[model samples]
Target: MKLTKEERIRLTYQIGDIIEQKCRRCYYNRSDDASFSINICAKCPTGQTLRQLGRYFDTEPRSRGGKTGNMPDGLTPARVRELNDQGIPDKEISIMFERSPSYVGKVKNRWRKHRVMARAESGAEEVK
Candidate 1:
């Protein structure tokens, strides 16, 4: 089913998240309060573009392109070291932990600088 600009924008962002509705021509008319309805945002850029393009328009939140997630819990430094000590490859460990291989490698690289890690590399037990 087709969605209106208000519906699409609402799907992408809540009314409170649309605080930065800026345009030189429509700046004064733009709604700044979360109290007002989405229709008050009609003068904003997305609405203006939608006005010009009609159904051919495609819109997504401007900030959606950036990396915007928190690191998942449990993939701690101790956990990573324990996984590395288990003879698991970084790729497999990453898959098991639901993290990227590069992130796992980065974690391992950061941990490698510890003197205990240096000793552990020579068969001594790692001190966490």
Candidate 2:
């Protein structure tokens, strides 16, 4: 479809904003075309024009809100404790839950501490 001059200008600005926010950091050196180097303040006519023509030059695919760095869906603290109880290593649990190993370790530690505190409280109640 043919875009009017104003529409073209708006599209260019939008593409430039996308490049500046997303592409500049991750995909700046990925493009073999040396002339396509991203500069946030500069007007990138070639990049903008290509994007205006419905071509995606960004490195990452545009998906549903992109990648979520947190734990995967359905992986709860109870599930983590169950996995740990079943002799699953933190690294393996992290992989299974799509979270970092450190996060799994922290969860395990927190659970352990909670259990210890609960035992101490129960023992005090029994003595009283």
Best by TM-score: 1
List TM-score per model, in order: 0.31, 0.29
lDDT of 1 at 100: 78
For model 2, state the Cα shift of residue 42 in Å.
Answer: 46
Please identify model 2 stretches exceeding 4 Å from their true place. Answer: 1-69, 110-128
Stretches > 4 Å off in candidate 1? 1-69, 110-128
Global lDDT of model 2: 0.57
Model 1 TM-score (2 dp):
0.31
Q: Compute the lDDT of residue 109 as modeled in candidate 1.
A: 72
lDDT by residue for model 1 over 46-70, one digit each (tens)? Answer: 5655444444334443465435444
User: Global lDDT of each model?
Assistant: 0.56, 0.57
